[model samples]
Target: MDDKDLELLRILEENSRLSAQEIGSMTNLIPAEVEARIHALEESRIIRKYTTVINWEKAGNGEVSAIIELKVSPERDFGYDRIAERLSRFRQVRTLRLITGTYDLQLMVSGKNVQEVSRFVSEHVAPMDRIRETATHIVMKSYKENGNTLFEQQEAERLPYSF
Candidate 1:
């Protein structure tokens, strides 16, 4: 990836809705060049997908999210990659990563409520052959997520109420 490619990525990262012309304006490249660069990025799997970060609370979705840590005895040669691939197939799994720490893997899962999350882990995750142990932590509140501030507790805006 060249400097131009990095610049294009940065521009798109801020706001994916920006047109090629808009990005080209910022990077001094022509619209056609910007489009071609973006296409190449997608083909190379560098730019995975364009996504929207929603304030689920403000939207009144009432969905709950949690971070779960897993300890697994990695399979023969396939190792953690095999276990990770199986976990990725589930719809509830939002994010999963293999980390070097006390635990082997950490997962971010979302569901309607705690019960749903518990059920998913107990039913699916716990039963996995390689998985030795699992720990789940439910999110109480989110101040920020995906680089967007959900709420600022310090800057609480109150409406003037008349009795």
Candidate 2:
């Protein structure tokens, strides 16, 4: 809300692991003040959750990820909210959003492999009452995510090929 609060949020966004004292030092606030502001942010839901963005490939737990666009027939009673909630309940669903676009809903899904993702769409998502169609786009590589670069400099570098 205030300048201090905004600055505090920026600091936390960079590194959530920073201690209250460290954050206070960077933001020019006392440790207690930093703690109070952070608590308020949490209560207000401005800071939903502190999370670590892991590079799954490097960790050797890489999962197949896809961005699926859905064109669904809205229910008469609750419209898209009801359907969105249903999709949210699935474990494969990572992110779901309703936007003003060609599709009614956009979903980011993860699975053990391509087959698993295809199966999820065919067996689970396609079976949903209102779902009319789905277009899946699998993520081949991610250069960056959540403002963090997935690949390091050395890994990105390659020798120039002379023709």
| TM-score per candidate | 0.90, 0.88
- The prediction achieving the highest TM-score against the true structure is 1
lDDT of 1 by residue, 1-163 (tens): 9999999888888899999888889999999999999999999999999999888888999999999999999989998999999999999999999998888999999999999999999999999999999989999888788777887458577889999
* Candidate 2 TM-score to native: 0.88
C-alpha positional error of residue 120 in candidate 2 after TM-score superposition, expressed in Å: 0.6
Tens digit per residue, CA lDDT, model 2, 1-163: 9999999999999899999999988988999999999999999999999999988988888699999999999988888999999999999999999977889999999999999999999999988998999999999988898899998867566789998
lDDT by candidate, in order shown = 0.93, 0.93
Write down the worst ten-residue block by lDDT for model 2.
150-159
Candidate 1 clashing pairs?
none
Residue 8 C-alpha lDDT in model 1:
89
What's model 1's lDDT at 90?
Answer: 96
lDDT of 1 at 51: 98
